[model samples]
Target: MDVVRRNNVTVTGNPDGPVVVLAHGFGCDQNMWRLTVPALAPDHRVVLFDYVGSGRAEPSAFSEERYASLDGYAQDVVEVCQALDLRDAVFVGHSVSAMIGVLAADAAPERIGALVMVAPSPRYIDDDAYRGGFTASDIDELLESLESNYLGWSAAMAPVIMGNADRPELGEELENSFCATDPEMARVFARTTFLSDSRDDLKKVRVPTLVLECNDDVIAPREVGAFVHDAIAGSTLVTLEATGHCPHLSAPAATNAAITEFLAALR
Candidate 1:
């Protein structure tokens, strides 16, 4: 299958500029990055794509077995980079995609040079001395509720995940994005996202990295941000004044500024 068509890859901006790939999180498509695209387009080659099971990606390309682990998503990133022949591209990943970027960068180090993680959490379930903002039972219940009724779970959780209750539309948009996804696929993605642990993977990131986190994100708390920063050597962590897991959507201006500043430093 053509990787571009399979992933619904979209490329734009200055072709000669350094490449920057924008990856969205679970339940979100490339459209989620609409607010941030323009900011980078003038100076970077921007690449956007939907994962096999999300957005407008070819549904037939989705395999539960293949996507059962984060490696599958990392493969998608690697293949997309290969298809574009991108060299030393900077990867900007949101939510779960941040860890996926880590895996992809490790898998294909030559293809990715730097990383920008937006509202990332290496683990969602708390362990001793580490607070990932959720307990094992909490995750189990969340997943069970989602498996039972994905739509209802989405409607209830989207608001909490997006935060910014003052902006009902953002929550509604997230809910719609969740609803648009295939329930079975979303369930698999959800399980893979919440249950997986990537703390050990952080040590593999040798490139320049910028970790962006929200001031108040229910999904990934400040402790999680500090954890990621401390885990990765020589990484910069910026706490946006935003109050949501999806800061690129809730606070695009701040998110974009931080990302652009990071990109400038990279260049």
Candidate 2:
């Protein structure tokens, strides 16, 4: 068995309750769930952490080639659960991390009791039957933006991450939270998030799952969320009437309520 040493894990809330591991999206890290922690803390034992390359993770672990696919990130999630000795945990993930959680849950279904996938996308690219919300040109443009001005693109994309561009201050704060990684590392992480497709793993998720989709998200739109719901057998899909890719920040109340309700139902 491979032992993955604990990286930058931020745990909070009840220590004795059922474990709830929260994973953040691309460009952002554990801090993105700050608003969510307070809500889940009173009842659930929440565990949050940065990927090996992002947030406050040990930068030495980041390798563009190694983490080029989703499996690399999934490995980190599995290692985290094993290191913490968490069992039957509720794995919550946002944006790209949502897909990571799915992959992790598939890898270790025994450890994960349920999956709360927020704004998850199994595949970002479009195929004949699937609409991943982003066109090939759109992704190319985003990659070009990353290449042109890494910092600027991060700033520009911050609103999309938080789902509120009118609040430039929020975007700035998100950009700061995501600024922990170097430009090269950020590029690597970005490529991994945007390129990998986890659609095939949806059918393999054995645990009970809930796919929460934001109302009007450009990144993972409603259709994609529905696709996930249909693909993942026995999983329920709920739409949060909020805009943006990061609902945990934009609509904490609704997000928390949905999570609470779902967890209660499982009990």
Candidate 3:
């Protein structure tokens, strides 16, 4: 119910069927999954919500220190699951939320039945052996860009997020999301997204999982997708031929079809 919003998120979905919790990534809110929800709602109970600072969540509820770490966001996921009494839930997370889902599922494995991670990265930064698909400098420039321009960074970042800055609407969409955030909170979110490393936690995931890889995704490169697939045991990997980082937007049908088939297989 509404009580779940106390810590983080604005939840929505069917109450009677099996729970399907859909989480969004950084710099965006649950609205990112709007297109994907309609397909899942009629058959399964669906849960769509914004993280503590993003989406329709009250701006006043966000905390810089509390949400500074991934655990804070993960805790919100756990709390919402507990409040709703959701068991054996299917968690569908995008980008950063996918990692958050991993952390939450690890914490409460008994409650989660399966995971569908879209554009997930266990560790974004590359190690000696692990190529997480990005370098320290890549993340540094991202943080710097976020700090300097903020709005302009989003405008520029949108094309990167959208994978098509040339597209006029991508610029506008990016502006709206960038401006919608609270400056301080946004800074903290950016820090969390770029800084946290969840590779260690991947081994802790005990439930059935699926990794949905987006081809030509800038945020989560194909290598990162391969890394996630290899790291998680007994997880299926599907490469989606979508251009933008947001597959649910750029290729909802493909995204939905993959998910629908996976859920059906579970049944």
Candidate 4:
């Protein structure tokens, strides 16, 4: 099978319309985009793919060293676009994937026309003058939880991590998504995601960018989103009324409207 197929690429919507590539965040795969895809599919050619180890991807394709860095994932994005011969396609990435989008756009400015970063965080650990919403020790504790009680950690942290405490169902969905991933693979991915520092790469973006910052995102605070917005030249930052990191899931309507407006303005 082709490389894109190995990644479990799923294409929908208008065959000849403007292309929109949706990259899921850290925990889950393309399925997480279920709530948001329908909105984009009507007008755009929507593309969804699972990262190597996360979703329905080929098990043998995942390499620990390759995925330990964001660049490897960025390469996947570039390859997906190249395999489809997509030029100037709009890239929409959530959470850690958002920074991956930034890296991809920088690497191939000609391939990506615009970028949308949902709850993006260039860095997760606070450093010097930066507020990344987490402390080094906090990350250590998180890793410890993952190691000690992988299942329990998944069940407990998913809700807290998802935010939107008022709605327990959303957290349940995230928990299920987190548990579906292979535990060992999830561990490595978590380390790679949280320890990663992509702050410097933001300025290299040569395409029009949009940063969608959600309210009450513990993983990516408002400061982190602002950092991304300030870092990328001429990037638009929109603060959604949707509370929680997974606004596309909990508040799909608002998330859909924001993405629609952003894509529309570009056209």
* Best model number under lDDT: 1
Total clashes for model 1: 0
TM-score of each: 0.99, 0.94, 0.93, 0.98
Global lDDT of model 3? 0.83
Report how far off residue 178 is in candidate 3 (Å).
2.5
Q: Per-residue lDDT tens digits of candidate 4, residues 68-123?
A: 89998998999999899899999999999999998899888778999999999999
Candidate 2, residues 1-267: lDDT per residue as tens digits? 333334587778988778899998887778888888888898889988888777778887777877888888888889888888989999999888888888888888877889999999988889888999887888889988987788888878877767777767777777886665678877877888887778888888888899999989988888899999999899999999888887787788999989989988887
lDDT, residue 259, model 4: 94
Reference-based lDDT, residue 150, model 3: 87
Q: How does each model score on lDDT? A: 0.97, 0.84, 0.83, 0.91
Model 1: per-residue Cα lDDT at residue 261: 96
What tens-digit string does per-residue lDDT give for candidate 3 at 121-195?
877788898776678999999898888878878776777777755566754675687778876788898899888
Residue-wise C-alpha lDDT for candidate 1, range 1-267, written one tens digit per residue = 999999999999999899999999999999999999999999999999999999999999999999999999999999999999999999999999999999999999999999999999999999999999999999999999999999999999999999999999999999999999999999999999999999999999999999999999999999999999999999999999999889999999999999999999988
Q: Any residue pairs clashing in model 2, and if so which?
A: none
Query: How does model 4 fare in lDDT?
Result: 0.91
Where model 2 places Cα greater than 4 Å from the true spot, the runs are 1-6
